[model samples]
Target: MPHTIRVLVAKPGLDGHDRGAKIIARALRDAGMEVIYTGLQQTPSMIVEAAIQEDVDVIGLSILSGAHLTLLPHVTRLLAQERAEDILVIAGGIIPPADAQLLKEQHGIAEVFTPGSPMSEIVRYIEEHVRSAKDLELPATA
Candidate 1:
């Protein structure tokens, strides 16, 4: 059997809202990807650690706290520090267009989904970009 695409959906910083995160997680699951939803108020370290531990193919951050500029890059940088930069980093929630562009261009975020983005679009983006476990050439012992 083929390996499923694993995703870690995280809510970083003081973003107490989680309904969008949960929705995205459910949509990913429905699309046959395994999703690990990190609930609200998670730190950048916690999110990156979980992604590494879970061997997730993608990191989906939901940031409505206006801290995307700070938190998003923090997680991306941590992943690089951990040598896990191959993992795709995507974000959602109230991100403005200019900041989204910066996140993608400077911080290396794969994509940023604004509110009202179609679920199918997000799912398709992951399917197109996220590599499966088999594609990573991980050791057999992994």
Candidate 2:
């Protein structure tokens, strides 16, 4: 059996919309990946906590309220602080080119997708980018 990639789909900050996040969650699930969706208005801390607790390999953040700069970076920073920076972080929705580049270059975001980006592309990216959970060396449990 193939290993399923575990992904946490989140909408951080005051983004009151969730259609895109839902679509992505469905896409990831359809691709045979385990997906957890954190509904609207989640804080960065909430997102990171869920990611760690769930032991997901990736975090997909969908932001539409124009707070990508603050929210995305804050998420990465929190993950770093929690020693969870190994989790791959990606973002989607309404991010500008410059800001997206900055988020990728400086904020530890793995990728950013905008409107009109195909769901297949999103699926393919996650499929290609996320390492299978089995590939990771887990600490020995007592």
Best by lDDT: 1
Which window of 10 residues has the lowest lDDT sum in candidate 1? 133-142
Task: Name the lDDT value of residue 119 in candidate 2.
Answer: 87
lDDT, residue 12, model 2: 92
Predicted structure 2: clash tally: 0
Expressed as tens digits, the lDDT of each residue in 29-93 for candidate 2 is 87777899989899999999999999998999999999999999999999999999889999999
After superposition, which runs of candidate 1 have C-alpha atoms over 4 Å from their true positions?
Answer: 131-142
Error of 2 at 48 (Å): 0.3
Query: Which residue segments of model 2 deviate by more than 4 Å?
Result: 132-142
lDDT for model 1 comes to 0.90
Clashing pairs in 2: none
lDDT of each: 0.90, 0.88
